[model samples]
Target: MKIILDMMGGDNAPLSNLEGAAQAVKEYGVEIIGLGDEAACRKAAAEKNISLDGIQLVNCTENIEMCDEPARAVRTKKDSSIVVGLNMLKEGKGDAFVSAGSTGALHVGASLIVRTLRGVKRPALATIIPAKNKAYMLLDSGANVECRPEMLAAFAVMGSCYMARVEGRKNPTVALANNGAEESKGTPVLREAHQLLKTTPGINFVGNIEPRDVPNGDVDVVVCDGFTGNVILKLTEGVAKMILGMLKEMFMANVGSKLAYLLLRSGVADLKKKMDSEEYGGAPFLGARQPVIKAHGSSKAKAIKNAIRQAKICVDNDLCGTMQAALDELAAQSAGE
Candidate 1:
């Protein structure tokens, strides 16, 4: 499969993107079409002794900075790497598009260029979070700041389809992120959403899930408005980092602790792997006509490479098509009612 990448979209820019592309090409046997300053990308690859055998670079003059306005930058910077790469996806130049750029800009570009599916009101950003035993999906991670009950229900449906089709979960249990697990809990929006999700066919709608219970991995999909979801995502990252740092400090405090650390090093390493965000690659902009992945703005080579792998899986599974079909079924059900 061919994946289009924004080579100059992240904090590390062309170097990290180029390295990731080379690794994806070599390891995953996927063709990567990079859009950015071709000369700079080539020079970086050469300096690193990285071969671009299965990669193609397309020259893009303009680069979109993080400070630029999302919609405005996308419209004005016609030649920017993010815009050009998204356009390439719209024109069917590649199976999927991956970017480690501004999240707002990526969301705007994907919606305006690739467009949303027929019955999808808004596209939600679905992110995989590593849990106790397995990973769960969080939708509307940072897409729509505000949403209606119907929109939350749609996110649940989309998230369920993704977890089942891509993550290989069968009839994934869906839960609403709320103040409590009781059906009477939460704001009007969430309570309404809970009723809607419970009535929505084809989705395994579980009860509400408090933010504290999210890490327990009891639910397969957690649906919430983008504002709340974004807060949860960031807070989870921050807490994980703090815990790991504290553990490190404690282990190195004295000779006795250092000896204990040696015994627990392997287990700690495994825990670190599970907590690493890079392991899940990037978040997918669900509801778009084609697959669009948004990698972290500060993504390194390893993260970008994994994002490419994530893109390939989405393309191979026809994620967009599956979402469209699921939405269509929901629409049909609504019309009948």
Candidate 2:
């Protein structure tokens, strides 16, 4: 399978992405198509001692800036490496697309290029996050600001399909993010969403789940509007950072604490790795007709490499086709009854 990588799309563009691509190619045995200036990519690859046997290069002259509007950038930045890479996927030149560029650029480019799956209202981004018990999938992670209850339900369905097919989780439980477990809790949106999820027979609707339930590793699928989801996602990251910082400060506050920290350094590192977003790579634009993985802007080689690996799993599992069939089946059932 051919996987496309943006040559200049991250904090350590070309270098980090190239290194990751080399690693992916070596480890995964998949062909990589790097998009950027041909000469630059060649120079970087040479410096890294990456074999160009299966690696392809496509030079793009223009680039969408980090600050550019996604819509405007997609329309005007025709020669950008990201646009080129996604176009390749749309044209069936590649199986999956991976980028560590502007998140907005990826969403807009993917929607416009590869297109959304049939029966899918909006293509939502979903991430498989590590929980205490097992990995859980979070949908519409700040992808759509406001979502219809039906749209949120669609995300649940798609997320469930991803879990069952890709991660092999059978009878995945879907839960609506809310203030409490009682049906009376949350705004009319979530309350109504809870009712819809319950009525939707295909999904394993688990009723309302609080934010605290997420880290507790209770549910497999957590659904929410992008507005609420982005807030919770960012807040979770912020809290993790603050707690780590406080621990470090406490550890260095005195000689006793320092000794204790040294004693527990390995355990602390393991815990930190568990909470590290980089270790999970990036999120996949789940509801689309094609497989697209979005990496963080500040991501390094390892993160980008993991994202590429994620795309391969997505393709191998046929996530798009599985999601399409599941949704079509759900829609037909609704129409029948």
Candidate 3:
């Protein structure tokens, strides 16, 4: 399968993107088409000694800047690599499109240009968090900041399908992020969403999941408004770094602490590995007609490599089509009763 890379997008455009896309081609044996200023991409590829055997470069002189309005940039920037790559995906030229550009641009481009699958009211962004035993899916992480109850419920349904198909989880527990686990803990939106999820047949809606439970790996999919999910996700990263710093400081403080650190060095290394965001690569924009995986803006070669790998997995599973069918089945089941 072929995947499109927005070579002009992201902070370190063309060069970093080209390097990563090349790594992906070598490791995953997948075809990659890099979109950007063709000459610059080719020059970068030559500098990195990246063979163009399984990769091709496309030209797009203009680009959607991170500060530009997403909807407007996507509509007006005809020569942007991100926009062109998205159009290619819509036209069946590629199985998926990977971008590290503006998050808003990716959201708008996927929803407006690539379009959502039929019957998907709102396409959601799903990010996988590496917890203790398994990864958890957080939906609408930054997609729709002000989500309605129906929208949140749709996130749960789509999130469930994602975990099941991609992560190989069955009966994945769904939880609504809230202040407390009590039934009446959150605002009217969460309260209403809780009721719908609880009553929705077939889905494993486990009660409200607190922020503390998120890192402890208590549930599979944490459903929340984009604001809350984004807060939780960023906080988790911040806290992980803070704790690691504290541990390192303590270890260097005294001979005994340093000795203890040496003893537990392997364990600490494993923990650090588990927490690496780049290991999981990009986040998938779910419910689109075609898969759109958005890699991190600061992604290196490894992250880009894995994003290409993810693109293959998404298409292999026919992820968008699967969600469409599952959502259709869920609606039909609800109506039949």
Q: What TM-score would every model get versus the actual structure?
A: 0.98, 0.96, 0.94
Evaluation by TM-score, superior candidate among 1 and 2: 1
For model 1 the local lDDT of residue 111 reads: 85
lDDT of 3 by residue, 1-337 (tens): 7999888776777777877887888788889888888998778778878777788888888989889998999889988988899999999998899998888888988888888876566677788887876778888787778889877877888888888887789889999999999989899988989888887756799999988878877788999988887887788888888999998999999999999999999999998989988888888988788989988888887788888888888888988888888778777766897
lDDT tens per residue, model 1, 1-337: 8999999888998898888888999889999999999999999999989888989999999988889999999999999998999999999999999999988888899889999998777789988988887788999998899989988888988999999998899889999999998999989999899888988878999889998899998889999999998998889889998999999999999999999999998999999999888888899998889999999888899999999998999999999898889988888888899
TM-score, structure 1 vs. true: 0.98
Q: How good is model 3 by TM-score?
A: 0.94
Worst 10 residues of 3 by lDDT: 116-125
Model 1 per-residue lDDT at 112: 94
Tell me the lDDT of model 3 at 161: 80
Full-model lDDT for every candidate: 0.91, 0.85, 0.84
* Candidates ranked by lDDT: 1, 2, 3
Please give the lDDT score at residue 291 for candidate 3.
Answer: 88
lDDT top scorer:
1
Give the 10-residue window scoring lowest on summed lDDT in candidate 1.
Answer: 118-127
Instruction: Please state the error at residue 117 of candidate 3 in Å.
Output: 2.3
Look at candidate 2 and tell me the lDDT of residue 105.
Answer: 86
